[model samples]
Target: MVAPPDNDVLRASALHFQHHDGSPALQGVSLGVREGEVLAVTGPRGSGKTSLLRCLAGLDRPQRGEVWFDGVAVHTLGALARARLRRHRFGWIDPVPVLVPELTVWENAALPLMLRGTGRRRARRAALEWLERLDVDGRARSRPHELRHSERQRVCIARALTVVPSVLFADEPTAPLHRAESAQVLRTLTAAARSHGVTVVLACAGPRRAGLADRTVTLLDGRRVRTLHLPPVAGPAGPAEGAEPAGSAGTEGRPACSLSA
Candidate 1:
C-alpha cells in the first residue's frame, strides 16, 4: 500500500544465511523495496528465495551483512526487539494457507487485531470489513475445515492482511489457486498495499501475474543478479486486515556484494 510515500521501509545488504554445517542457503544478496512498490524475488526451488525473505523479515538472521528497516539494522537487534518489529512493523505470510480448523472465518481474520489489544467487537467488525473487501463475507461463519481449498486460501490471506502493516512479505502466495484465483489474490494483495501505502515484497518462483510487480529481482544460483521495474497495474484495494507498520526506507540499492562472487 502506497500511503503518501513511505518515510521508512526496508533495504538488505550483502545478506547471507547458512545452515548448521555452514553450507549456504542464501549468499550475499542486496536489494531495496519501497513503499507502494511490490518486488518479486524469484528463482528455482531451493534457490534461497524463502531464506532471503526470512532474513528480510528478521525471522531468520544472516551470517553476514544486514537488513535495514526504517533505518534500523535488523541484524543488530535482540531477539525480542526483532519480534516486536515483526508484530508492529512487518507481516510475513507463507505461500500455503495456515488457518485454524476450529476457528470461524471471522475469528481467523480478527486474530491479529485482537492480539494487538483491539476489543473483540472492534476486531470482528474490522474482520467483516476485510471479508467484504475480499468478497468473502458470505464465508464469515465458516470454519477453515468447512471451506473449499481456494476459500481456505483466501481466509488465510484475509488474516494476513487484517493487521494493516507497513510492509507485507509473502512467500509463494498463490501456489494452490487455479490460474484465475491466483490472479485474483494477487490483485487483492496489490490493491491492499497501494490503498494503504504498504509495501508488498514477495518471494516468487518466477510466475507473477502479468502486471503485479513494481520491481523484480532475479536470484540466480543463490545470488541476486539483476533488478528492474514493472509498470503500475491495478489490484484489489485491501483485505481489511493489518500487516505491519512502515519503518525504514532506502534509496535504490547497489550491486549485491558477495564473498563467493
Candidate 2:
C-alpha cells in the first residue's frame, strides 16, 4: 500500500463504494486533508459528498481503495476499532439536528464526553462553554423539542465542538439555518476549530457555503472534477438577459479549472 503525504492527517486514494442496491456513491475519488486545515468538499446533490465524508470518517467502509488517518490504515480496521476511533478522535454533524428528547440541551452536548468516561461536572462545563460560544447557552436547560429548528442545530454544533475532536466532519452543518444564522454558525465553528488546531472536513452543496475553507475539492457524479466559474454574459436581449456557466466553480483564492464531470 502507498503511504500518504507526511502532512496529510487524512487521506483517501482511488475510493470506490456503492449502496446496497448497487447505486454508485464514490468512483475513484481521492484526496488528502492537511493537519489543522479546513477542507471543503463541494458538489451538487447526489454527487457523493456525504459518501466521501462517511468513508473518511470510518462510518462506512469503501468497497475498494483505502482510507488513512495519522498514517494508520482506517480501511483495514475492524468495526469496533473504527467505532472507538470515532468516539475518541472525531466529531460529526449531520444535515439535521439529532438529540435525545429527554435530555436537556447541555446534557445532550455533554453526552459524548460522558460516554468517553469524563466526569459529569467536567463534561457539563465543557459543553456549556461550547454552547455559549455557539450562542445557544440560554437554551442549556431546555429540551430539544423546546427549541426552534435553528436553535437545535446550534446545539448540535456545540455538542460536536465540546469534544474538540481531531477531525470534525460536518455534512451540510448549516442546512437547517437561515442565511444569517448559517454565516454565524460557520464562523464560530471554523474559528473554534482553528483556535484548537482541529482539522475540519466540511461538505456543502455549493461554493457560497464553502468559502470559509482554506481549500476546496469538488465532486461530480461520484468523481473529482475541476470546476470553473465563467462570468455571466449578456444574451440576445437588451440589458436583462445573461448566461452563466452550467457547471459549478471553486471559490476565489483557490485552484480553478474548467468543469469536467
The model with the greatest TM-score is 2
In candidate 2, what are the lDDT values of residues 1-261, reduced to their tens digit? 667656899999899999999999999998999999999999877889999999999999999999999978999999999999999999999999999999999999999999999999999999999999999999999999999999999999999999999999999999999998898899999999999999999999889888899998988778887764433434576223443334554533222334443
Model 2 TM-score, 2 decimals = 0.89
Q: Candidate 1 lDDT, tens digit per residue, 46-68?
A: 76888888889988889898788
Can you tell me which runs of candidate 2 are displaced by over 4 Å? 228-261
TM-score (C-alpha) between model 1 and the true structure: 0.81
Q: What is the C-alpha RMSD of each candidate to the true structure, in Å?
A: 12.5, 5.0
Q: Which stretches of candidate 1 lie over 4 Å from their true place?
A: 1-8, 227-261
lDDT of 1: 0.75
Candidate 2: worst 10 consecutive residues by lDDT?
249-258
TM-score of each: 0.81, 0.89
Report the number of the highest-lDDT candidate. Answer: 2
What does the lDDT read for residue 147 in candidate 1? 82
